[model samples]
Target: MKMIKTAFCLGLVWGASAYADPELHFVDLQEFNAALDAIEAGESPLSAMESYVAQASPVFQAYAQRYETSAASIADAYSERPGYYRSLPELEGYIRLREPEIVSALSRLEAMAPAGEVVPTYFMVADQRAGGTPVLAAGAAGPQINIAVAVDMIALTAETDMSEFPGGTGGRAEASDLPQVVIHENAHVLQLAAQGGLEAYRSIYSPEGGNMLAVAVREGCAEYLTYLASGWRLGDRHVYGEANERALWSEFEAVMDAPPFSVPGWFSGRHPDHADWPAQIGYWMGFRICEYHHQSAADSDAAVRDLFTLYRPDDLRPLAEAYGASLSAN
Candidate 1:
């Protein structure tokens, strides 16, 4: 149950009685270290790992429920890539080194987010096979959304081949992208909080008549905010989208309301039309939509809040169209 807690006074600007103190839990590293030690000692890691999960901090336990954190799943993952598992301890060291900066980055959220919102952040070395990032889970204590980061995956070297991974090259990032991913995902947590709650936010992504534009704009908003906060972009999508804006928007508009996996796979992995293009180009379009809308809004704070508050296609279509119209004008 070891975790670090910090509370920041966001002042009285956002019109709140109080703001929830954000907590960062590094208990996952403790669990991994204990389990790794047992493995090296020629002892079973299952017992230690299980005990750790049972006694884990509330945040880590919530993350465990979403992903396969069982010893068997982890052992299987280790069996596949023993070298990767071994690298985690060293990565744990890396996370510790960057912890201060990570906390500082997360602290910036106070101004952007609604007051009294609690975002519990967790850093963990978990099973990479589960594909952990932007990790948000619902718990009994309101929306228990924790940003569960896979330290191992983020620590992967750029030179390492990711072609065999789930999203291939399209759905991955290197160690350097860690700060941006954390901030981007943190923005998502606040966005979900603003858009009702986790369940409400989840409803928008339903495959049944789900609007890809909504998903795109939602992610785009986060991407845009991440850039504003951390000055980092998600892969090369922003650059690629900027260079080929007109053509991409032309293709994107037709399928923006289609299911997320409809055609070009804009938000999903692998763009079918262009093999060389980066993955999730929908993110770029979404980013642009939010950027244009935010820039045009008279009230900056209200404009930023609107990005997360209205996630439906009906609400966001106007913004997208306005951006599209502006594109034509340009």
Candidate 2:
């Protein structure tokens, strides 16, 4: 697909980590955009990643620099770069969104944050962790599983939308979906704190680890928090955690039957919502456990704080004790 360049200058850069990475800095819009254009033209997300590593973490720079311009352009061209939509735009935009409506909605939710809730540190590409900015991979939340703390809110989208008009719906995806994507990726930021992310992921999984369950928990928490942040507007992933129960479960019978692709997981199956099938399931279902745990906790803020410690459904069984429920079946 052909990509076009757009004109723009710096407006803002954001992240998930509590403390910004010292190494994740960039030279503002001009230099960053030029570098990013080069990346979208032919650079691999991995190779292009290093150029972005710094106080601002390439993850943030990745989105800030090219996502809107490049990803949208490539998608506009309807190219075959399968990941062109997701890599360049989808994930990053979901994390550091620029849409006006979403921000306005967030402004109205401040009154809901429990005063005592220990707002988990917003996390992002860690300075110590290399291999580019591990935005979605590190994970974060209002609680601790890896490490407990109250997460004020996580941005998650209940998006199950997709298209192939040009750059695939993954880029200019949709508003409802951005929150979940944002929260899930940020959860990875939280993970970096407890396990050094890459190293911990390796230890939990296999030689090719990238622990899918951990990824799900990180993602799930983000989804759950997005709902908490949005006052449950994002929808419940747990109610349909079981594939058989989801509205599209029958259409996607084989979804979530395996782990995520470490090399670069991509699901191409087309359900009613494009390729949003199994991928959406992971984020939603995984989060349900956390949601249940959160609802059951006497002190909701404490539940948020305990979220980081959770890495799986089993981990949640004990956590949900306060709710007198067992998530072992999940």
Candidate 3:
């Protein structure tokens, strides 16, 4: 229950006096870890899971209800994964080791956040498959964020031990990057708030709608904002390097104006081998567009504010084209 006040500063997008720092509620990872320990010591894993669910924060409870499943089912599924439960102690240790770093990172992010009405609740869980990865993290306007710590630590360790997962890009392995991931997801929370709250944000950006522009705007701006807030890139190595980034932008420009689903294939985790592009290149593309918009704007702060508040995809075309022109000129 550590409460870090929002460090108010002048020149913020929402003004210095606008929003107070939201209370960050860290879940009791120790209790959860002990539950896992009990499971390892021969207690019924499901029973342990049920106890956890009973005591979880409202955000986690909502997450469970959203999937139309009980928390026990979700916990059971995670336990079913090979080496999942066994990894809990190691994961807890990793989190404890990095607690200071995580807090510091969050402080940096909060410093750059706009004043808003919603204060988000933050927590950690043990689901590897919760979002897209075992260490999946997600954020929304309720300002709720959940990180699956154990799975993420395992993945991080695996990546460190091995160069990269088979058919996976092996970048972003350092445990130091964990805070940046949290910042990226927090950026989503801010974005959702900017775009008329959670339901509206989901309607336009959810995968079911397949709105490429929206997805690009949503995710790209999030990644870009994370950089602005934390000075770190969300993904692997290639994106931060100038040469590879320029090439990827050039390719993305060709289809930047394509219809919603026209170039959807390009956004997949599996990128084309011939291009030597990193997976999820769409994130990079959107980031570049937002970057150009920010750099080219008359008021940079306003440009960033618009990134979160603006919902139209077509409005971003000029920004993308401007960036493309600069790339070609170079």
Q: Residue-wise lDDT of candidate 1 within 83-163, one digit each (tens)?
A: 666666565566567767766767776467763253656777655633334443444543344567766556667545443
Overall lDDT per candidate, in order of appearance: 0.65, 0.36, 0.53
Per-residue C-alpha lDDT of model 3 across residues 1-330, encoded as one tens digit per residue: 001112211222232333345344456355566667767788787887777777766555544444444656646655555353444435445645665655555565555555333233344454543331111123322233332222333245442423223434333234455555566666665665575443343344433443566666667787787787657775464334355767666666666555554564355534445346554567777777787888888997798787666656566666667877887787
Q: What RMSD does model 1 have?
A: 6.1
Best by TM-score: 1
Off by over 4 Å in 3: 1-24, 67-85, 89-118, 131-155, 158-175, 198-202, 206-210, 254-268, 272-276
lDDT of 2 at 287: 65
For each candidate in turn, give its C-alpha RMSD to the true structure in angstroms: 6.1, 12.2, 7.5
In model 1, state the lDDT of residue 180.
Answer: 70
Q: Which stretches of candidate 1 lie over 4 Å from their true place?
A: 1-21, 44-58, 67-69, 115-118, 129-143, 158-170, 198-202
Cα RMSD, model 2:
12.2
Q: lDDT at 236 for candidate 2?
A: 41
Which consecutive 10 residues in model 1 have the weakest lDDT in total? 1-10
